[model samples]
Target: MTSAQVAKEHEGGEGNRPEEGYERGLGSRQVQMIAIGGAIGVGLFLGAGANIAKAGPSLILMYALAGVIIFFIMRALGELLLYRPVTGSFAEYSREFLGPFFGYFTGWTYWLMWVVTGMAELTAAAIYINYWFPGIPQWVTALVFLIVLFVANLISVKLFGEIEFWFSMVKVTAILGMIVIGLGVLTLGFSQAGDTAAVSNLWAFDGFFPKGVGSSLMTLQGVMFAYLAVELVGVTAGESDDPEKTLPKAINTLPWRIALFYVGALTVILCVVKWTEFADEGSPFVKAFEVIGIPAAAGIVNFVVLTAALSSCNSGMYSTGRMLRTLAENGEAPRVFRKLSSTKTPALGTGVSVIFMGIGVVLNYTVPEKAFGYVTSVATAAGIWTWLMILVSHVRYRRAVVAGRLPSSAFPAPGGAKLSWVAIVFLLFVTGLIAYDADARVCLYVMGGWYVALVIGWSVLKRRDPQVTARRREPEFEKL
Candidate 1:
């Protein structure tokens, strides 16, 4: 079948479609909050300290530049979502526009990305818990938090939305508060740690690029990791109550989010407390509040960062389940995963994902110190693949549009296919940066093995179920 026919077959039947199994319970407010929450992860809250230490204030420019590229990628995704919103999102786009192999690879690779990402988040959550409960073992904390979040996700999508809403509110409120307080300190000439708060602090101790351009370039891996989950909003298009309105509004705000949460907040922190004061091991936000003599600053910042980690974990569980269900629907995964609960939740898929996340809990026990860095590196590399596929799929989608195989999108991407190529090159450069770092090179190696394994698994599945493989090759949808 042609790509156009495939799109119509999967567009959710008029009245009694199997797609109805997914509850469109996420309202505009929840979606907006999910977008905000996805953009701001524990990376910004905690990992920024290391980047700032390495790049000094030049980290702001890194974020701004990366944010622009990310915006182009999102616009590309937005155009595709507007063309045909589906629960599968990028995976579905890849299937129709690129090819079935790409579709399979994108779907499963994305699922693997989130599963590992959830592991990293769970590790961070455990570390954060140690700040308050030094007596607890890290593995115990990780396991407990994983179970709690897994249960929360299994209940319903609405509950997931509510949990994310409050979690995002905490992160947003904390950043805004820090920005306001940092500005106040600068204007009122508050002195703390024998250094007066002033904009001059950005350059007084050392120039913005204190470590040189090469050193700043080294931090791009971590900087990109911070933006890992930002495109999660596209995943929500399947369940959003008003995807036509909410998806655009949520995506359009990417620029300001980078400005305020990343650039604006980092500028304030540097001005309030010199970048020299931040260490690679602790949160700059916590240290800034501490230097300013805020009582319980460590505890407060710890609580906020903990919520940020949990929020990411929660989102991971939610997205992995949906992606798996999409795979099953497309005959790329086990049939059992296609079943949804009466409440329209992918209970089986979520349970399976949580089972895999248990490996993270085990790693916390065996390699607590290295688990976060290792898993995060792998997740970042996996994220690069997912983003690259989005750009590729969008390019193919535009070709289909021009060839009269698909209609023009209501929310067309600016610059169209050319911008996608630019973004693709930017992603490649970042991947190269990852290879340049001896510590991060492991991620690429692991990702190489992962793709090899996926090819083997795909081959095995195809041989075992020739009919399902044939259906996948033909590009026509069948009713569940």
Candidate 2:
């Protein structure tokens, strides 16, 4: 049968798993790059300035500590993905291990998270474009980028993968080049900045915690936000060529990617120029490059950050569609969302998501400065919820396996439930920190509203289409 036909055949019943219908066009390299790209966003490029102004050199410790928690989260997710790799990701696991309500909430919450994130990325991309084309309106650039990525995602999964691969390559190359240059300044004294380039810069400025320990602690909100999309790899499992192998490999590399990109890069930048020299005005990378006397430093770094923005927007386009499809398959969303196009893509759902994402262009046109910031905290909270579900689901899945109620996974997480609990607690602590921040605390209230909305939505779904909200049949271990 044709793939779409097969996909249709398997639908209309809860017997099939959520990941079955899509094409596995993503290869190992694409999966790895997606993971890397997800980990590295414009947050590092631009947002770091404000964070540095808050935490000083101690920001490195926050990223490192959070990085460890993120690793545990991914390892837990990795175990579940190996057992039942699906595009539905944590949303699906939540359904199986938690219940239909949680699955429904996670699926829709993830969809909202990416849709808003797409808007933010588009806004960021448009602003970066303005640096080069001063007359082009932010809304115009945002619309153009949204259309390009939407079309790319619909054409085929492979095209989406290729677009992301190249986008991530630009980001990876820029960070690597900057690190190498920074090291040269420190060791071989390559640049004029080398005159003062000393690792001691990390300590010389206010002894690392210049703003006090509480100030450093407060940067956790931004640090965790920077780590938001690393879980994108889990969603790629359904479309990956060999998920069992690729997913684990993609997740395993997250620690080094976090280290090199966040911790290592920051260490070098802080070493090359003390944290005190950094400001919340623009990219520390751009400023450092200018200090190093690199030609067109602003322009080059702008291009890189622009790519960072577009890369993330592209990912949002790709993932939101899949999340919608997963929700549809579970009857939590409209039935039409489950349909696959000739290219084996969720065209309808993706198009709907893109339409909503267009609101970002409008926001950019109107609010320009606050458009991205307004939605970022909500997105971070949504991400934290997604991670919480993954850890909880993994813990539950492990317990079932140990009880022999379900077979063990091919890839088991080390330290099992204990590690998952640690990650969960750390995430909760971050959530508490978010609640503590006056400006950020509003997200908690927003999320409170979101939860009530979900509760209402769930009640409506269960009443209107009992089948849509039907509990999934108990999971069956795959036959060897």
Q: What is candidate 2's CA lDDT for residue 467? A: 74
Model 2: per-residue Cα lDDT over 147-240, one tens digit each: 8899999999999999999999999999999999999899998777979989999998779899899999999988888888999999898888
**Residue 94's C-alpha lDDT in candidate 1?**
79
C-alpha lDDT values of all predictions: 0.85, 0.87
Residue 169 deviation, candidate 2, in Å? Answer: 0.3
TM-score leader? 2
Error of 2 at 230 (Å): 0.6
lDDT (Cα) of model 2: 0.87
TM-score on alpha carbons, each prediction = 0.94, 0.95
After TM-score superposition, the amount by which residue 18's alpha carbon in candidate 1 deviates from its true location, in angstroms, is 8.2
Candidate 2, residue 315: lDDT:
90
Position 288, candidate 1: lDDT = 87
Q: Could you tell me which 10 consecutive residues in candidate 1 have the lowest summed lDDT?
A: 471-480
**Could you give candidate 1's per-residue lDDT for residues 271-310 as a string of tens digits?**
8888888888788899889978888898999999999999
The C-alpha RMSD of each candidate to the native structure, in angstroms, is 3.2, 3.4
